[model samples]
Target: MSTQQSNRVTAVYRTTTLLAYQGNPLIEALPPLNSFIEDLSALRGSLKCTPEEIHLNGVERAHSICRVIDDFFQPLSQHIQLHERISLMIRGGYVGRNPDTGDWARHIQNGYERVLSGDLKAIKFTEVNSTAQSMTLIGCSGNGKTTAMKQLLSLYPQVIYHPNMNLEQVVYLKIDCSHDGSLKEICQNFFRAMDRALETSNYEKQYSMRKRLSIETLLAAMAQVANAHALGVLIIDEIQHLSRSRSGGSEKMLNFFVTLVNTIGLPVILVGTPRARKIFEADMRSARRGSGLGALFWDPMDEGREWKALTDKLWSLQWLQKRDEVLSGEIRALWYDLSQGVLDIVVKLFVLCQLRAIATKVERITPKLMKQVYEDELRPVHPMLAALRSDDPEEIIKFSDLKLSDTDKRLLELQQRVALSTQQTPEEFAYQQLRTDEERRVYMALKDDFNSKLLAPIIRQIFDQNPSLTWIRLLPLVHEYLNNPELSKPKDNPKKPKSTGRKASVKQTEWHTLDSDDLRFIYSQTDSNSEIYPAISKSGLVLNIQSLLEEAS
Candidate 1:
């Protein structure tokens, strides 16, 4: 939570229905628990758009469609259940440590005394069995674990300031686990999260910025701040990033989480990819701690009622010119095949396909268009989708975090550029065609003055003629062809047989049946419907233009 988030929530104090949650200002400050219907109403991330909006200019419609990324959450049953569980966790954690009863003050004093004595494990306060419990959510990447949690946490005011008690009750604090997974770093992050949640620098400045502090001292200090503020529930995301080598092995980190729940009375929620499951399974005690509230393992959705329900809701938010009032079964089936029921991919694929529809003037999503968008625009997640498609356990296990590779990231950006540009250049459409950085570098250099339509083929001509030529040597030959277009004309070569009359006269659309070297054949093979520039460069085809230009330059 930042200052901006805190401003959105008014500190309206309210009474509670449950006995355990009553009288504690920490629990009382929270909104009352509502019926399932109310929870569903509060959790939806719906977007608003009209059929008339599709008549706007391409760029405007594209900008409107992009809103789906931030504002198109449809609350599923799992989301509502998660919300209810977290609600219980927060209120349950506060039950044993009501501030008015001095139980909370005693916990804070005990933590300080432990720090002062330099013995974090010492028992300085009267033991009151904690109602605090910990839970874990393990799932595949992009299954909406983090997004769902953020939306659920938003239902509570993060920081509630009680002027009379002069305390800032942090309703919840969420932090990312460091890549190193060091518990000391986690404690430092705790202080940093507290600073952001309360808009104060005291804890972070005093504890986190200190250089000579021992890990035990940091833990004691961190526990004190959490107790002092009555911090409700602590969510640690990316728990899969925890490295055993750096964090003194998985057992130490698990023990620390256990201590937070069992001793410090702070409920903990660990969210991570499936890789984190092995960390918790290191020992039974750790596994028990992880399942205090029953751990949730979210597999990718199957093509069932839940999938159809979500897709139907998402289908209604289209900004396409030729909007289909109902989703056709063929397109729906194709969508599932492409996305494989991963929530993030499902939404993003829809968004990208609509952008493609508007950009190409197709103005409607077809099974063919959706498939092309997935193939051309979504190369980054090919491996992940392949693993899911295989249904093989070993292949799926290899991907803990199915993040995009660097090259595929560039491809996605190119797609967005092509989709949004009203005056889209040939290079924007052709760039995705160039497979290698070397090919793209040459195309980009000459694309400013020469048409990519003309430049890409000539570059391919040079590369095909001189396969061993470096981009350095390739640049000059491309420059010569840009100046003299006729130099690229086909000429007889001793290496090739003459084309048959039938082969030479093949119709353009049916030219894919011709030799692989034919430009018409290459153009017929592309996944994108935009232009033939990409396909021309993709096949190493060119006329005698490179040979004549090479000699002239």
Candidate 2:
């Protein structure tokens, strides 16, 4: 369940250029700091789709290509700043806690004393002042805060093995604040995360599994584990959830996070939505500690060079039969209007438009189709998008971060069902019918080319629509329908029976939703935004190259 993977690398310590970073095994084992351009190039996502792959004649393949966009990250200025800040924080924190010296051992001893005494202040026994600092990154839900963090973290090994000292140097560990924002849950997750990184059940068994352990005892244990492993940095995401913390639980968590930096010599990065700003603002001491490395507020992307660069790159991945060689200004403006510059919405909008274009046989993205997709599929976020558009402080405050909750997923499902109901084709009407032998023969022949379940409806509809046509003549039409499903759109059926139940009265069209296998659904289920594509890929949503080749053969 842990999102981060450990790269158990042998310690390859280099002489660091910076004086403060020099002579520390923890700092020296890291990949050497690079220039801005080098970092940018390294951080940019490498996943790409070719034109041949895009134009592949299969709905499933098309969906897989669309899902690929989830992995398409282009580092911007904000990412560079974050990279530098985190890079500095981790190495700087390690400067004072050299494992070669007695400093690290002493720190561990102090932490064990704290754990034994059930006192957070017991770590103050050491004369070595922590060089560690904490940072806060606040952004809108879909603006790529967690994504950037994860990508940057990928530069360093999550777990490093030092054979000389028999140390498992955990470079970093990230955990989410629980939905209820319980400090106890956070402590348990920390232990679990550390256990995962270190490949040991000792920490989890010793601390987290004990139900009767006081929060103070748990905090002491958590801090001790962090020091015992020489944890480089700690990242706590969804800090906005701390708003749900009851009876000053939020304050206690904040104070403990500060102690991790000040006492344990571990840098901390707190990532959250705009709503979390109020928590920091309430306490001056916590505010100062939280922003020791300067807090970053990530607004939704604007229509600037970064936006153009991202869209231009994304626009090039069209799998439509009629690929638009160039992105036009009209469609670009419409995209911004609909997504309001949220990175997730922006990418999903592009993806859904392509899927819709393939379904409707438009073959190219247009402003009208984009708008229609937005209206039909993305209605759940309309209010949030509207709030962003208004740019009014009061209006924005009324909405929560646009994380797709269970309710939102239900809304997407209902919306999709309604869309399917209203847009029912002739194929749908004749789907179950296979009354004649000729229809059965046609089904047997085409089932090999297409999915059996999907081909049934197309074959049935062809026979019903052209009753006089032979099975020989119907083959071309069936293939055509497979390519363009909208070719046989049904006319209004006034004679059709109407629903009498309460379900009929329910306004289903207003309920917006997405499907279970949709990338958005994968995103919702995932813990880290950075891991969305990996999760989707593992879900069998992305097209497999070997399978494609085998099918072609």
Best by lDDT: 1
* Cα lDDT computed for each candidate against the true fold: 0.76, 0.74
Per-residue lDDT over 30-122 for candidate 1, one digit per residue giving the tens place of the 0 to 100 score = 777764567666677657777678666566777788788778887777776788789889999998888888789878878888789766666
Candidate 2 wrong stretches, greater than 4 Å: 1-6, 243-250, 405-553
Residues 512-536, candidate 2: write the lDDT tens digits.
1223344554464445768778877
Query: Clashing residue pairs in candidate 1, if any?
Result: 488-545
Per-candidate TM-scores read 0.74, 0.73
